[model samples]
Target: MSGKTVIARFEQGKETFEILVNSDLAYEYITGKRKDPMSVLDAEEIFKDARKGERQGEEKIKKAFGTTDMATVVDHILKKGDVPITTEQKNRLMEEKRKQIIDIIARNSIDPRTNAPTPALRVENAMNEARVSIDPFKGPNEQVEAVVKKISLILPIKFAKIKINVNIPPEYSNRCYGILKQYGLKSEEWLSNGSLSAVVEFPAGMQTEFYEKINNATQGRAETKILE
Candidate 1:
């Protein structure tokens, strides 16, 4: 595994530093799986000999990073150096994220002018028309807002946050509870009369489909109120 380690090089002014980290850890850091890339470095072991006045580990780290401070090395790795993944791999990852964003928009957004859910294709087209760029390193949730804002300029769109209060009779509560949970239940309670009441929030684009699911589960026995 040591032989498969990745080297990150950083240079400032006339000085240069090379840091070693495991290939897997480097990939994770580059892909946002790990928040800090330096955490992957075995800093403790590198400083272990320093505590005993040997300075072997410290010297080696200093030689690699120009300083023994792991934080500085981590920052440099983040700001510079190419990610170890290939361009094709990065493109595939970005494409997957782009699909996820499209799915989210289709499920949660609507055309304000028409008051109807936006079609997935239209949303995708709008994204392209607006020239929205999805950050390969960011999760869909983190990047969707900006993407939506850009697309909205080309289409009359809005991502609606809606809340609904629902009540289910005892006979349907057990079966319906699971379905409701998938829609983002915020809070739930059981009534003394053996009923289930809950609050759920989800994208308004899903309202019709969600209502149909709830209605079918409860056989029209569920009462739902859209809370303003």
Candidate 2:
């Protein structure tokens, strides 16, 4: 890992525990990719004030973390604590999460004007210009709505779902049910004639692709209607 040392801090009832750690490995530990917390630390000592060189007593460490075992205590501190990160590292993480945020928006949302998915490049451009900020630690899915809201003002965007009534010929019913469920088969019924009638709901942006799949599956014989 990067050998750059930094402090990871966590506070309990009346105790604050700090550990000096390698910045890169500390992140991996917190993210659970690293199983051994001690491997990330620069020093084996816990401290009430690391910068002051004031070491914490074992009793206090045990009281604050339940067990004074260094590895477990270190795990708690790194996972539940605030770890200092460099500006460059923070920006790099935000950029990666930025792409995830963009994918979520582009996949599930559509341009209301055309009822189609906006080009991914357009969404990326909107993100660069949007005033919203991305949280490096919080998941990208959690940040998508706020980012979409900000970008919506500049792009004709809206989150939409399309419901469809689909009828499959008897020959294709068994074959097409799997496809229906893949998109979202809301409900289904078997007609007396042995064909399948299903209600499907999926993202509005998938309309073109959905049509392509269903038509291809039935050799252009599947019939469907938009629900309103």
Clashes of each: 0, 0
* Backbone steric clashes in candidate 1, count: 0
Residue-level lDDT of model 2, residues 86-166, one tens digit each, is 787678778878888887777677888887776778999888787668988777888887888788888878888999999
TM-score of each: 0.63, 0.67
lDDT of 1 by residue, 1-228 (tens): 332454555544554445556666666666567787666654423322222433235555577567867776565554464335556757866888899999998898878887677888999999989888877756798888888888887877887877899999988888998988999999999998889999999898898788999999988889999899
> Who wins the TM-score comparison?
2
TM-score of predicted structure 1: 0.63
**TM-score of predicted model 2?**
0.67
Model 2 root mean square deviation, Cα atoms: 4.7
Residue pairs in candidate 2 whose N, alpha carbon or C atoms collide under 3 angstroms:
none
- Which candidate ranks first by lDDT, i.e. highest? 2
Score each candidate by Cα lDDT: 0.74, 0.85
